[model samples]
Target: MTNRLTKTLLALAVAFAMPAVSFAQDTCSNRGDLDEQYCDDNHDLTADTPTDPKKLKTPNTLVFTFTPVEDPAVYDKIFKPFTDYLSQCTAKKVVFFQVQSNAAEIEAMRSGRLHVGGFSPGPTNFAVNIAGAVPFAVIGDANGYQGYTLNVIVRKDSAIQTMEDLKGKKVAHTAPSSNSGHMAPVALFPALGVTPDKDYKVLFSGKHDQSILGVNSGDYDAAAVASDVFDRMVERGVISADNFRVIWSSEKFPTQDFAYAHDLEPNFRDKMLQCFYDYRFTDELKKAFAGADRFYPINYKKDFEMVRFVARSAGESFNRAAYDKQNAGKK
Candidate 1:
């Protein structure tokens, strides 16, 4: 049933969606200081220069959202305090937008409809490349970030127990754009004597958390997921950490990233990124974040090296082409 549903969704996402390309610049005509290339300068390591810099106009209403990794409705409440704070900083009517799919989120940023939001670690590359999104900060501890690993897990008593044992078994991965959830395993599992979609059928469980739960419930033989999602599930009391055991874990990967539209007014970029660094986690923010207390500064060029490497190995070029290709199946 799980595999069938996943294939159905993949087929749907592929059929109706081709790929998203930045067709034109979302520039404003009446601006004096803004250049035609304002939408995207070469500062971002992702895309080519924008044709029109005038597209960098600030909206009267600053729209924001979180990474759509887990439940979307839950984060609307989780980010409310930050939304309230952003309104004060940008002097706009701030709203927490609960976007459904990664495609929609990219579209929002491209059309100047979305100002700032968070994209999960792997997908951040696409947002930067395809949607012209500028990544800023990430959730971190006192020294830096809350990094994660791609963990291969199975039930304690399951007959198949290791990455080597996963041959011909059912395994659940998250979205195609997911790193720890999909790309890591696809890149590494072959060395372990198993290959995804070849040795075992590849299934998209829609989310990392769902994949974890499916293993516990016997819906899948194993799952490849981000360590952070696994930890949060245990922290939320959805499942016991001990009930499951890790068979394999990849090298350290970067944490989730907070990004804004590339066309954001230059004057506001500093303030917005600063807002992410300055705002202390509110009581409710702390709860939504699963025990993480602060947002910290991270130089994307330096911090995202491992993430970029993993993405590249999966034939993901961190360009508009790869970004569009990955989301072509999502509705």
Candidate 2:
């Protein structure tokens, strides 16, 4: 979903929004394309600053937000401690922001209000390119880097006993941009005799947790999701592991990413990275992490290459044109 989001330059007027600060409304010029409103800035794309810096300045109030991967309200509690730590570590007022859609999350960062954030599987590229976030760490344990597998799960009593048994049945994939939940299944399930959109009718469940719950409730015959998310659901007693079984699992794939904005001052940037690695998950956080205990260090070029390959295999190259197209229809 976050196509070439990495290289994106935020559209000036759209990306640099400053709240509580107003601009003059433009009256339409006759016969102009409705969408074609012209904007001219000094050589730099940023809005022309006020002659005196004070007029253009906004106080720095560090904002912390997370990915839109799950219900924001619930995860707000899960991440409370981290937000508190950011407040202490950065010595700036920090607030945890919850967003309901991909666009809101992107806009928050692009507008320069967002300081640090966690981005989900596909949208990290967009957060980076359009928002100027720099990737640093991902939640993981000492055993190895944090990762998830694409799992095909079914109700414990469902007659879908094998991957081959899923033929002609209804199946759910989280969304187009999801890796373990959608892309991986499409790229790897053919050998199982289930070619999505062909052998089976595919449904969009909107999220991995929903897909997992759907399988348990018989709303779906089978669904693909991130293994860690499924495990955490069981661990939370939100669902029982015994209620379902995995019929198929794909190669291990990268987990969620943690990032900071690229425009952050240098000294502040170093401290944020240190804080991420040093913050240990307490028991409750471990529960939220599905049993993970700490943040894992990663080198994007190496750890994420396999993910890039799988995405490409599924026809998503993570380029700008594709990202714009994906974002075009989104509200």
Candidate 3:
């Protein structure tokens, strides 16, 4: 039985269906910002099928990944229960492929090595534009969705009392493609009387845990990170919430997205999404997720619009050139 959210989503998909065959002759022309390998004939703001039948795929073994925030090994363990359920549901081997970065995860899906995965909020647009990923769900239970806020943290004893105090101090951002960690700061900070690159040179900490840990250890004067990751670290005793002071925090943004490679066979795609929606989080998984349960429905063009707005405001696009530029500075 389709749940209310799934039913509504299916209806929306049908309503958005276009005469895709008519547009195939142009070989993905007028795809807007999407990569040339895809077409958006439906104007649904996502990739459509390849005109060639041979381009569609339904692999016997499905690959899955989660966005790299903390230790990949930790998430590998955290997601094990879900993978086991997915394998049984699909009657195929499901394997969790550990990804070291957002770029690598998107590339894996683009190259057909990854079947489904979670993408961080900032890079979700990049995955849609450049990697042909179709986002469908996020971690949530009965409450509808999961969200996080951008938290600017400094040591509790630090003299920084306001955003202005960040000037001339070392400030860390998680990665170039992070919503709370980087892009939101670039977009929201200037209005608050602190400019990132001008007020202080941005330091890339590679991950949220690193940024928080850097602040805790005094490696940085302050750092911007997602509140959820910070809470998880505190719960796990990696850091204490009391040890830091939040100088600034932004409104909640949607957490990471779960998306599938766009070229999947229609039936396979439906079944894959159903499998995720039907599964409930285990007790430990719920606690780890801060109480989010099942994978809840979402529309990429709607749910991620704010993230795209922030990216655009920062003069950023998810194109290959932009992706390469960000990763080029990686240590």
TM-score of each: 0.82, 0.79, 0.90
Candidate 1, superposed: residue stretches over 4 Å from native = 1-53, 287-290, 329-331
lDDT of each residue in 133-207, candidate 3, tens digit only? 999999887979999999999999999999999999999998888888999999999999999999999999999
TM-score winner? 3
* Model 2 TM-score, 2 decimals: 0.79
Q: Write the per-residue lDDT of candidate 2 for residues 91-180, one digit (tens) a residue.
A: 777788898765677678767777777777666655554554556778888887677888889988888888888789989988776777
lDDT, each prediction: 0.76, 0.71, 0.89
Model 3 lDDT, full chain set: 0.89
lDDT of 1 by residue, 1-331 (tens): 9999999999988776654323233433332112233433334364333345775566788888888777788789878777888889767789988987666787788777788888888777667766767677788757667678889999988887667788888899888888888877777888888888999899999888789989999999999998887886776688999889898888888778888776666767677777778778887665555556778777766788778777767766655556656666665
lDDT (Cα, 0-100) at 241 in candidate 2: 90
Ordered by TM-score, highest first, the candidates read 3, 1, 2
Clashing pairs in 2: 4-318, 4-319
Q: What lDDT is reached at residue 196 by model 3?
A: 91
Q: What lDDT is reached at residue 309 by model 3?
A: 91
